[model samples]
Target: MKNKSLYLYSFNQRKGIFLLLLVMIFTQAIYFFWSSNTTPQKDKENHQWLALQSHVDSLKQVKEEFKPTIYPFNPNFISDVKGYRLGMSVEELDRLFAFRKQNKYVNSAKEFQSVTGVSDSLLAVISPYFKFPDWVNQPQKEYVKFENKISDVKPKTKIDINLATQEDLIKVYGIGPALSERILKQREVLGGFASMEQLAFVWGLNPDVIENVNKSFAVVSTSGIKKIKINDLSIKELSKFPYFNYTIAKEIVTYRSMKGDIQNIEDLTKINGFPVEKLKFIALYLEF
Candidate 1:
């Protein structure tokens, strides 16, 4: 009878135990539902972050593509892409290539134009940025300055050869009193010198003396000399001219007798050993 009473007493708390069990079951259900959602929520956040990151990267790439920047570069060393960027055509690039193949470089903007034949408008746009090496620019600058200064400087006073006095002629280093008189006599015989080159024909005036004469004297006033007809002159008469020797005069007379007339200096080139080099010089005093 005591054991039955104890069992009945234990059964009296069964409602409270069932309610506590229900509470535990509800907490476990809540915990499991939270756990199931946590990973997918984190994954969703990660996917959004990745999409944002990709969009930012694409924006950066577009910015980089559109950005315009140019740096000074040597035209001599330009590659195809660089040249294209500078607006050079294929033919212009090819010209630069061919010029470079000869181991030559474009030293100046002008030289670059001459080599590549770049249009003036395009050259105007790109030329300011063309950075040649220091050596390239320096020498050209110095030479140009030298030429400009030379041109800018006043010419020293000079006396015309035809009008120069004997005292003036003697001022040249090699010309003595006798040489000065000889030059004056020759000037008188010729009426006046047409060119300083005629000084070479002055008897006993060697090349050294001629060089000295050129320093102080110049044929500034061109005086016309009488031109002789090649057809009319005998070999003897032609040989008497300062330029023509006996053999050359004979050859000329023979060529004229056979060929009718030497139309120009070109016609004289056909004669054997006609001093073909001096044809132009000789042509100065000859009429056909």
Candidate 2:
């Protein structure tokens, strides 16, 4: 009787274990089937997301391709007939020629509305690209037609730097009474700039204004100053000497660094852009 009872218990335990195993296997099969099948709705969402991403990428590429080109159109002006050079970069020639009167030209892209002939649609197109150079000012100044007052007769020998008064300085374009006083003050302070760059150091001289006027002034320094430092001179300052511009001055400074200190006047020949003739003129006043 005891052995039969033990055998019955063992048989029941085996049946219970087998039933649990069968249930686990059935649950795992259902999970695997569901995971393997993708729903149409989910597939559609993925496809749409990929298409949207591709379209965005294409638009980005198009913007990048045209980023370098300049386009000018005042967005306000719909009438295209009156607008000339509607889609062009501002050239120096354009700046000079576009002026009908002094200070009348549309400078800022936003200022296109002020132009007399610009239509609303044309201004709308040009507003984005039509920025004014720093020199252009608004509330237009009257165009003083250049009077060739001193054409044939040379003026009473160039104004003497040592003795020139405030009135003397205002005769030159771009130099005002205040700036003229400042120039004299700087000369007194630094014992003269030892170079033209000193004018740039004046309290209120605008760099662009200096550049424009520098070409007209000739250096008559009889004081025998020599060897102006190229690296220390400002563009307007360096430009006062004959045949020197910002570009040439920059090249000289660069060459001085690359080749080490300029050894002698002849050493300038090794630098690009410094022609022999130019070097001869420059050698008179330049030092290492």
Candidate 3:
């Protein structure tokens, strides 16, 4: 009886151990399945936050890329969208102007290039905006010869009578010292020659001098407009006429605006420092 009782206690201990191991395995498996399904939603939210963070980082990079660049004479910091942007290096401006003569219409880039006077090394920098304008640009034509080629030779070298002083007038073939003095005296009395044919008016200016000079010379045409509209002519062209500069040209326009149309040539006298006799000498070149 003592031996059977000892065997029964040992058997009970073994069974209790086996039952504890089975429960532990079952609990672990349940916990693993619960975590796998539940953790995915939290991971998805974390992934979305990471993507938003990437976009936010890109915003800072863009800001740095477009910082305002400075250039001489250009007060506004506005960047060029099509040609070049502000804040670009010296190389950028160089490329924009490189083909300027071939492509004249890229206004801002052309202006910048003119201002900066870029060199060859910097061309690659601004080449992105060096697009040629369609309106003004023609496809470069090859120099092909056709049978009826017109010569580009000048018609002839003409004496510029409009530019000649009294000394220069004497250089003409038939104008002697006496004739030149007579011409100058007549110019003083009559104010000026109204036409090239008026060379006959000089006391001793022979027909031969008039004929030779006419072949190489032309008088300024007066047949156009009897009155001048100041705003029509460019500043350089305006300055070519007697006693006019940028300030005077602008003043003429302002005066016309304030007073209305200039009806006669005498109206030019209204502007300050306008020499009436000098104007009469130059009137043939101007028109309304």
lDDT of each: 0.80, 0.59, 0.58
lDDT tens per residue, model 1, 32-132: 99989998999999999999999999999999899457788888888998899888999999999999897677768999999999999999988988897
What lDDT tens digits, residue by residue, belong to model 2 across residues 60-166? 99988864454644333323332344543334224433554353444465454444444567557545665443335334446778777776976545444544566
Q: TM-score winner among the candidates?
A: 1
lDDT of 3 by residue, 1-288 (tens): 977775665777968888999999999999999899879977999999999999999998898797564334321222445235434455554554454434332335445555555544443455343443331233443668766566775677665554456677666565656766776665454344566765755544556567866876675533332333464765565665434667777767677779875555778788766656566544554554
What's the count of clashing pairs in each model shown? 0, 22, 1
What is the TM-score (0 to 1) of candidate 1? 0.42
My TM-score estimates for the predictions, one after another, are 0.42, 0.28, 0.28
TM-score, candidate number 2:
0.28
* Backbone clashes in model 2: 22
Which 10-residue span in candidate 3 carries the lowest summed lDDT?
70-79
Worst 10 residues of 1 by lDDT: 135-144
Winner by lDDT: 1
